[model samples]
Target: MREIQYEEFEEKIIEIRRTSKVTKGGKNLSFRVVAIVGNKNGKVGLGIGKAREVPEAIRKAIADAKKNVIEVPIINGTIPHEVIGRQDASKVLLRPAAPGTGIIAGGTVRAVVELAGIQNILTKALGSTNPLNLAMATINGLKELLDPRKVAKLRDITVEEVYKGVRREGNA
Candidate 1:
């Protein structure tokens, strides 16, 4: 058996609908479901499944999401830098914020970011707010994050010193 690492909760189905197509003999019906899965611990996944039954489709979507889990790096409870991502029609702009800023986001992007363990950040959703697209865009933004420590090492400077300079400049 495969072990499940994420504690799944808040399972939601969006755009649940049924459609029918007329064939030569009869009409064939199909169902579509969009599923969102998350651990509420800085890890989130999304999957879409289509089937004849709603329950089976949801189960399949959850399984697929689990298999496709992606790890998002967190720094000081926020992202390291600004990032722009697109998923279909959804375009998201994510920016890291200083401590105590809290999360500034809306719609599905908010849920994904919160679950991804981001505490202080800013986000803007452009183009569309379709749940799946927004979620995917948030994931894309998370994937582009780079830890401040890593950036500090790359620039050969201490993280604290970098912030100290910013503080000094802000107070001036």
Candidate 2:
């Protein structure tokens, strides 16, 4: 198998927050970052890092993202089918769009699909609008995508049958 390098990925930071811990020695301050990394060729990842400084938090996030990388199948710069992902109270609905439509999404969803190399898509952010939850929900949706060839093999059918929705009676 070919190894994927982090250097090939583009990184985007979605959120940065300053957190405080009340302690006897005054308040301990820290930074939290949410980041996503992608290679724009069917691979992406999301990570969160917390640290005492911004750069450290970002660095940690990038490293964590690299470890959790996922493969996103892109068909003509869009997903092969519609999907919905849920993270806590946040639900993201992803639908493939016609060519030239571009990505119609909000902040977090845009970052994820763009990095995943999807060029045309429509999205709706339902329920909670929290950035962290929304980002996680997007990742979950992408993760649920299955390659058509793989699906055909699993169902003992041809790739054309998978696309045409023609299921073999024996297999069904």
Candidate 3:
């Protein structure tokens, strides 16, 4: 698949926060934003940016997200297998769902999974609720996906042959 252009992808603003720090003279103010970039076609990325203004933070987050994009292995609008991804104190569990199941997830995990073009999935946040960590963990889960074709090649067999005997009417 060809790489998706930055302009062609959709940008979703995940969160924005105003942070303050105590200094010698006064409190320092800054804005932090989490942004997700995607084409809704098996590619997505998450990025965090901090700046003195909200717009600048969002722009920076988008740019960073574009640079960090990853291609997901989409199988019939869902993941190929179940996976649990962990980052720092956060953990995200991902599972493939039947057609029309939609995305079963919360704010952070849902945003990441949806942006990755997964139409049917089940997600659960296992550990931390931190948006940043949760987003990273979700990304990690996608990264771990293995393509069935690649696995078939590695095993010296055709894709359909890999499941031979798993069905009741196999080889009939």
Cα-based lDDT for every prediction: 0.75, 0.93, 0.90
10 residues in a row with least lDDT, candidate 3: 163-172
lDDT of 3 by residue, 1-172 (tens): 7774565889898889999999999999999999999889999998889999999999999999999999898999999889998999999999999999999999998998888889999999997899888999999999999887888889666777654624334444
What tens digits encode model 1's per-residue C-alpha lDDT throughout 64-170? 76766676767778776789988999999998889999999985777677766788988999998877788788788777777667767886768976556444444
Model 1 vs. true fold: TM: 0.75
Q: Candidate 2 regions off by >4 Å?
A: 1-7, 168-172
Clashing residue pairs for model 2: none
lDDT of 2 at 68: 92
| Tens digit of per-residue lDDT, candidate 2, span 26-109 | 999999999999988899999999999999999999999998999998888899889999999999999999999999999999
In model 3, how large is the Cα lDDT of residue 149? 81
lDDT of 1: 0.75
Q: Candidate 2, residue 96: CA error in Å?
A: 1.1
Question: What are the TM-scores, per candidate, against the unseen true structure?
Answer: 0.75, 0.92, 0.90
Give all candidate RMSDs, comma-separated: 5.0, 2.2, 4.0
